[model samples]
Target: MTSIQVADQTFVAAAPELAADVVGDRASWRRWWPDLRLEVVEDRGAQGVRWKVSGPLTGTMEIWCEAVLDGFVLHYFLHAEPVAAPPAEPRELTRVLADSNKALRVAGKVMSFEVKDRLERGRAVGAPATARSGTA
Candidate 1:
């Protein structure tokens, strides 16, 4: 089996709890990494999560969050092999790598921008904000 590996890192400008809510929440996870069909194999609260990836590439992926001085650092790791036969040409390999890299970048953007916005705005991503105690 041909081996494949990918690593990406991004920082979310929010607390660990907020970052986790955006990244770890199943709904957001699906929205962020729509290309990947992943199931949680391990859930490490305050640390991150591990998932079994399916689809074109079959492998294991993990996303972990670490508290940093400014915010939270997101670490993404993927190690897997193609589900089908290996790419026949150098071009094919390049194409596969490009696609995967694009996906990673998109994920990073979603986490850093979309997720951060939702969490920092005082509401969970996709969850409605609750009424203030006294405000109408």
Candidate 2:
């Protein structure tokens, strides 16, 4: 297992295709993961994207859009280790993992929430899906 492993899922009351549009933007990848350079490993259309990542860390990352009742359950994962040599001390590795965990978690939430809010527009909590897209 990598020293830093992060997995996050968010339920967005928006259709899978809509979510895919935002998450699959190649240009936006720079903004979403500024520290990592991502090369497409798989482009799964409405399903999502998998990337071979390299930069501060090296490994695979993915955003999977799962169709649920009303919308997509976005699953985000990052399994990577530092690109540099492994830290010599366990304490240093732990600290790095903790910090990376926070930063990555926040980044994932921001992306998911952006799509949720934009697509769902003024949807009240517990409101029914109202996206006008044909699939919705």
Pairs in steric clash, model 2:
none
- lDDT per residue as tens, model 2, 7-31: 9998888767777677888877888
Cα TM-score per model: 0.70, 0.89
Top candidate when judged by TM-score against the true structure: 2
**Largest lDDT belongs to which candidate?**
2
Candidate 1, residues 17-80: lDDT per residue as tens digits?
5555456788877777777799899988657889998887788888888877546777877787
| TM-score, cand. 2 vs. native | 0.89
Residue 83 in candidate 2, Cα distance off native in Å? 0.7
- Candidate models: Cα lDDT each: 0.69, 0.83
Instruction: Report each candidate's C-alpha RMSD, comma-separated, in the order given.
Output: 6.1, 1.9
